[model samples]
Target chain A: AQSVTQLDSQVPVFEEAPVELRCNYSSSVSVYLFWYVQYPNQGLQLLLKYLSGSTLVKGINGFEAEFNKSQTSFHLRKPSVHISDTAEYFCAVQGSNYKLTFGKGTLLTVNP
Target chain B: GAGVSQSPSNKVTEKGKDVELRCDPISGHTALYWYRQSLGQGLEFLIYFQGNSAPDKSGLPSDRFSAERTGGSVSTLTIQRTQQEDSAVYLCASSLGGPSGGYTFGSGTRLTVV
Candidate 1:
């Protein structure tokens, strides 16, 4: 079984400020990590994914995440944030069995 | 033509009524999934269908929830005896299977039980 833990429920940051959303996972088997963002009344959209190879992976909308095998973490980061970046983000892990497990989610609120 | 599509963007039904939500996955997609998202929360997996094989219903919250995929493309999720607690945005996503590519999602159906 695989489980994701997104430590923060909400994060508020000023415009153009760097921010990081923490995520950790627990799995006994090999895992694939992902980050998804959802706007109000919209469906979830994939921000990025970490399948294999390099530990650091870049994603759309100026976002990036690093896969840490030892730490069991895949934290999302952005050099700077804008008002448009305010949304709900979810961290997920797909286990060896192909079941996708998601964390509770973190809400990013960027204020101008 | 390129993305997953969902129908009946909004639905309002009586508490005991049954409702059906539809999803049209991307063309040639072999894996389809259903999920539910309540206000201020993340998505909860409901079921998954891969090709013509049996769907994984392990995430279904109860027997009242059921889903079916025909022609390995479109899928319909039915909720019987809908309750207030059942009101949420039902989301549908499609992927090529495996972990390589990210899943594409539809706009989702907002179900409101009155």
Candidate 2:
């Protein structure tokens, strides 16, 4: 079985400052990693995914995440954050069986 | 549909009242999934329907929870004898399936069992 662990439950950052939300996973086989963001009362939107290319994957709204095979980590990073970027972020891992397991999610609150 | 559509954006039901949530996937999409999101929790996989394959019911938390996708387009999740613990946001998502694209999610139906 595959599982994800989001190290932080909430992260507060000032506008225009950098932020990183940590995520880690555990699986015996190869996996595909994904990041999703959900605004209040809204559905989740895919931020980025790491399939089989470069470790660095970029996605919508100036967000990016790096896949680390050895560390079993895929942490999301934003060079500069905006107030609108505040949302709940989830990290997921799809195993060979095609079951997507998600972490507990990290709430990003960007303050002015 | 242009995007995944879930009806009854919010529902409040008394305990023991059964409720059915609907989900309409984008046109031509083959895979649909159901998930539950409780307060302060992440997405919990509930069920999955992929093409003509048998649905994966491994994630259903209990026998009271069940889902069905008819005509390969619309899905209905039914929670019988609903309990307070069943109160949460039920989300639906669809994808092309098979490692091709990211899933498109609906706004979800926030269910409150009082």
Candidate 3:
């Protein structure tokens, strides 16, 4: 079974500041990792994913994440954040069984 | 549709009533998924459908929670005798089937069981 853990429940940042949302996963087998963002009442939007190859993955909206196999972590980072970046972020893992296990989520609150 | 579409953007129903939520995946996308988001508890996987094979229903919480995909395109999630616990944002997503491509999500149905 695969499980995901998002380190923070809420993160408050000033606009244009850099931020990182921590995520870690536990799985016995190789798995795929993903990061998604949810704004207000909207559904989740894929921010990025890590399937194979490079450890660092870049995603939409200037967001990026690094997949550290040894540490079992896939942390998301953004150089500069905007007020529009304030949203709920989630980390997910998909194992061979093909089921996506999501973390509780981290709410990003960017203030101007 | 250009993206996954979920009907009944918001639903308010009395406890014990049955409710049905619909999802239309993007055309040609073989994999469909259902998830529920509650207040503090994050998104919970409910079920998955891929092509003509059987669906992975291991995530279904209980017998009251059931879903069906017809002709391998549209899916309907039926919750029999809904409870307050069932009140949440039910999200639907579709993918190309596998790890190669991530999933595309719909706005979701906000179900409020009174």
Candidate 4:
């Protein structure tokens, strides 16, 4: 079985500032990682995914994540954020059975 | 028609009542999944249907939770004698059939047990 852990429950940052949402996972086998974002009262939208290849994966809305195999981490990062970037972000891991395990999520608040 | 669709968008049911949530997967999608998101919590997998294979019910919390997919296109999640803990947003998603293909999620049905 696979599991995901999001270190921070909430992150507050100023507009134009950078932010990083930490995520870690546990699995006995290789896994695929993904980041999804959800705005208020909306469904989740894929931010980016790390299936293989380059460790650094870029996603929509200027978001990117780096997959660190040794640390078992796939942290989402943004160079500069806007107020609209505020949302709840989820980290998910897909194991061999193709089941996705998700972390509790991190609430990002970008303020002006 | 183009994306996964779930309804009714919001459902309020009394305790001990039975509720059914519907999901219509995208045309030609071979994999469908059900997940529950509690308030301030992440998504919890409930079940998944792939092709004609047996549906994966391992993630179901208890016998009170059951689901079925019809004709490989639509799915329904039924909760019998719902409890307060059953209150959550039930999300439905569909994919081309693998982790690499990713998934398209519906807006979800908010089930509120009173």
Candidate 5:
């Protein structure tokens, strides 16, 4: 079975500061990685995804994640964040069966 | 039509009662999934339906949880004798039916069991 681990339950950062949300997965075979953001009371929206090719994948809202095959990690990063960026982020992995295994989400609180 | 639609944005029920949640996936989507999100917890896979294949119930937490997708377009998740632990947001998603496809999720139905 596949699983995702999000190291941080919550991350606090000031506006205009950079942020990184850590994620690790356990899978025996190749997998697709994704980062999704959810605003209060809203559905999840794709921030970025690493399907194939480049290890560095850019996504919406100036967010990016690197798929490290060696470490089995897909960490999401943003050079700078705004108060509006405050939301819950989830890291998910898709195995060969197309089922997505999600991490326990990290709440990003961007303070003004 | 444009996005996955779930009914009864919020539902409140008493213990021992049965509740049903509905999901209308995007038109033409062959794959639909149901997931449960407890407070302060990650999304938990409940059930999956792909085309005409037998649904995957491996992730269901208990026998009290049951789900069905009809015509390969709509799905319903029913909880029998709901318990306090059953209170959570139930999310529905759909995709093009492949390992490489990204899913579009609904706002979710919040079920509160009293």
Candidate 6:
């Protein structure tokens, strides 16, 4: 069984400031990691994923995440954020088969 | 190209009524998935459809929740005797059936059970 933990429930940052959303997972077997963003009333959009062969993954909107196997973490980062970047970010783990376990999301609130 | 599409963008139903939500995956995609998102919560996997095989129904909350895919393209999620707890944004996504391929999502159907 796999489970994801998002350490923060909400994060508020000023526009143009750097931010990191923390995510950690627990799994006994090798797993695939993903980050998804959801705007209000919209479905989840894939921000990035780590399948294999890369520890650092870059995604759309200048977002990136690092997959740290030893620490069981896949943390998302962005050097500068925009007000449009405010959304709910989710961390997901896909273990054995295609079933994905998602963490309680972290809401990013970027203020101008 | 058109992205994954879901019909009836919003639904308001009385308690104990049955509701059906529809999803149309992108062309040539073989894997389809259904998920639910409640207020201020993460997605909860509802079911999956891959080709002609039986769907992975493990995520359905109860017997009232059911889904079916036709012609390997369009899928429908039906909730029988809907309860207040069934109200949520039901999202649908499709992928290329690869371990690394990311999914394309639809706008989702916001079902409100009154």
Predicted structure 3: lDDT? 0.95
Superposed model 5: Cα runs more than 4 Å off: none
Better of 2 and 5 by DockQ: 5
In model 1, the Cα lDDT at residue B9 comes to 98
lDDT of 2: 0.93
Model 3 lDDT tens row, B1-114:
899999999999999999999999999999999999999999999999989989999989999999999999999999999999999999999999987788899999999999
For A21-83, candidate 6 gives per-residue lDDT tens digits of: 999999999999999998987888999999998799999999999999999999999999999
The residue-by-residue lDDT of candidate 5 on A3-106, one tens digit each, is 99999999999999999999999998889999999999998898989999999999999999999999999999999999999999999999889999999999
Error of 3 at B5 (Å): 0.4
Model 4 stretches astray by more than 4 angstroms: none
Q: Each candidate: fraction of true contacts kept?
A: 0.72, 0.65, 0.90, 0.65, 0.68, 0.68
lDDT of 1 by residue, A41-83 (tens): 8888999999999999999999999999989999999999999
Off by over 4 Å in 2: none
Q: Per-residue lDDT tens digits of candidate 4, residues B26-96?
A: 99999999999997768999999999999999989999999999999999999999999999999999988
The Cα error of candidate 6 at residue A11, in Å, is 0.4
Q: Relative to the unseen true structure, what is the C-alpha lDDT of residue A108 in candidate 2, on a scale of 0 to 100?
A: 98
Pairs that clash in candidate 6: none
How many backbone clashes can be found in candidate 1? 0
- Report lDDT (Cα) of residue B73, candidate 6: 94
TM-score of each: 0.98, 0.98, 0.98, 0.98, 0.98, 0.97
C-alpha RMSD in Å of predicted model 6 compared with the true structure: 1.1
Error in Å for residue B7 of model 6: 1.0
Q: What is model 3's DockQ versus the real complex? A: 0.89
Q: Per-residue alpha-carbon lDDT of model 2 for A40-91, expressed as tens digits?
A: 9999998999999799999999999999999999999999999999899999
When 3 and 5 are scored with DockQ, the better candidate is: 3
Clashes of each: 0, 0, 0, 0, 0, 0
Estimate, for each residue in B33-69, the C-alpha lDDT of model 1 and write its tens digit.
9989887667889999998889999989999999999
Residues B1-114 of candidate 6 have per-residue lDDT tens digits of 389999899999999999999999999999999999887667889998988888999999999999999999999999999999999999999988866887889999999999
Candidate 4, after superposition: displacement of residue A65 in Å? 0.6
Best by DockQ: 3
